[model samples]
Target: GGPRTQLEYRYVGYAPQTVEVGNRTMIDVSLEQETNELESVVVVGYGEQKKATLTGAVATIDMQDIKTPSPNLSNSLQGKIAGVISVQSSGEPGYDNSTFTIRGIGSFVNTSSNAPLIIVDGVQREDVNSFNTGIFNNIDPEDISSISLLKDASATAVYGAKGANGVLIITTKRGVTGQPRLTIKVESGVTNFTKTPELLNGVDYMTLYNEARRNAGQSETYSPRDILLTRSGLDPYMYPNVDWIDEVYKSFSSVTNAHLNVTGGSEKVRYYVSASFYDQEGQYKVKKMNGYNPNLSYRRYDFR
Candidate 1:
């Protein structure tokens, strides 16, 4: 042999090749280097759509967002979605309903049913006012898988008759492809009036009354013993400068809720079973009000 020779290679990617001379042995492997980015797809009513493909003006509320600071389903939707308005007509416990509208006023003369249609898990839920006795509690927000509102006519045309007003499509939780998944959610918090009114004290009340009397030029030194006693603090119980509103209202009301969900299975039969317990009290009112709502739900989904 004349002299020994050495070969060197410099490259960024694999390229299989062979350098041969008189007699030599070599093996090479070429592999395509790739960078892949994974994405999630959400299924709307009619077809499958990527999150980015949505352009028809829609709002999505998921389960995790429901189980947060506020347990009120109607409160959760307040100002969260664009072009949607939720007005809570009353502050009474267990009596809150949201009036949902789409793209301002769709009808010029029809105000009877100005609200958008509400569909829960493919079941139409109209005439909610008829059931406003507070007998039925709303769907547990924690149990909701997703809430999608169809805002424009183009998105609402699929459901035709029901979509004339608008669409509020609610899909409940379901099972995934895995072992049985269990989710436990618990929330406890106080409920207080946003702004409580202030009533006049007894002294102020008498002062106002006497001032009115003076203004009217009635100079009869009106001395109702009850008023005199109240001014003198003679009988605190009988003429107490009591805050009747505070006396009737609680220092703070409370609500506690707990729910458990069991889900998951194979391809054939996937199921979701959930139960919840809720106890809530009123914020500000003359009488005390509390509620207990125990719910059980079962759903079987077939992937056909």
Candidate 2:
């Protein structure tokens, strides 16, 4: 008969509600606190703030999403975060950390780097791309609570010129209001190249060389007898066709990571302590005797 009316109410911290006013003289409504994801806390360049209140671009990642078996935390950031490009140049055991660029490349100089500013627990770190003195790779992924990327002008505003490139904030887990909780994780895995390069063996390499010489109207470097000898792989001292790849490198290597962390405390004094162990073997090998270890390996232990 009459046009129906409706009322909607919403607030920043409270849930939104919609009510219809039909054939009712009086209506009572109760509003409860809203659990908005925008209200979740995130670490910024200087401090922490709610995502809803942030002016610049900020991206956060869940700890569960980055729980990878990789020894370097940067390796797990690939494909997980937006505007973040991670390029892993090598799979070397201890030097496998990915090169990170937020949004895009931050530098044009060859000597300078394009890595984002890495801050751990409010302390500024030198460089994430350091292969010799790498501090970022040393950080255990288990101890990290959250990682936030300040990806725009807000990044520059927070830390001045240093943040011009981008800011990668890593917040470690702190004590919470509860009993002492112990977390132990032991993971073992095998690391390997996704696709091993197929190289031409001695026979193929020699034959190809001879073919190229004939095409160029030049004398063949390898003769038919040489090709046959190489194919037969006889008398390595004379007609040697060695598979250097197989001799110097293995098919795959093993990796082991173990973490032990404890978090607990009252409202007054909170505490979070952790110890982590990481062992990664290189995909390299050499001749050895006397039970000697001629294998390249990297081992690290962290206490925080």
Candidate 3:
């Protein structure tokens, strides 16, 4: 029954009512962003350290940002942080070890161990590859509580010898000091490859073969005219085009992962145990190859 303005302003206080009128009048409303002092904490070695005390540059990859579809853990980190380069290198199953480097190329030699030192929990591992690729590749990247990369010499000095290249510290899930907590994670999807290469047809392949023989001064090795007549007009099945890459690659792949975690405890005895199951079949049969560490000897073809 009253003015339209009164109806809109009836439920709100003066501040909100003013904001509504400003919008109706096309006036810009600006306010300073407020930050919480209690929320500003830097992640140090074991726990959160105040951000103000941090001396060296440390970048962290937290859980919420990582809880997405990432087939390779290394691929998840690509271009997400400054000064960190993660390369998938190869997609072969067991060998899908991602190589990481900080800043740029710091070593003179290409084959030199240019990988950053990887530390898990409180222990330092010789190589990130020391663990099975299957273990790290399939697990939820979100399971990682935090991944802190230490780049400067000041940050690298603590571990000494192994820290020469750089340092990467990884923290896994831990118990919280509250009521028993449960986390159920589930992901289902399909993956496939595209843009494959083409192969030569029977006629073209024979033409190339004949030309090679003629150039090698073996004119009689291939009867070009007869070869063309025999293959040119035949069904494709009679002269099958074998696309090796396609023959070895699979057209369809799917994965399903589910995990359940339980944790909660007092200061003295805290415990965490999680069991996960992962099954992945590749386009290639020898998807994962763990070759001989060191070959004892090489035998001739039938000499064994």
Top candidate when judged by lDDT against the true structure: 2
Candidate 3 per-residue lDDT, tens place, 126-165, comes to 5543345443444456456787877777666777777776
Which residue ranges in model 2 land beyond 4 Å of their true spot?
1-35, 105-114, 130-133, 211-228, 231-234, 288-295
lDDT of 2 at 286: 57
Per-residue CA lDDT of model 2 for 118-170, tens digit only, reads 88888988766665536888888788889998888955586887777678889
Best prediction by TM-score = 2
To one decimal, what is the Cα RMSD in angstroms of model 2 from the true structure? Answer: 8.5
| Candidate 1 segments exceeding 4 Å error | 1-42, 51-55, 69-72, 105-112, 127-137, 224-228, 236-240, 283-304
TM-score of each: 0.70, 0.76, 0.65
Per-candidate Cα lDDT values, in order, are 0.61, 0.80, 0.58
> Higher-lDDT candidate among 1 and 3?
1
Instruction: For residue 29, give model 2's deviation from the true position in Å.
Output: 26
Regarding TM-score, does 1 or 2 come out ahead?
2
| Candidate 1, residue 171: lDDT | 77
Candidate 3's displacement at residue 2, Å, is 48
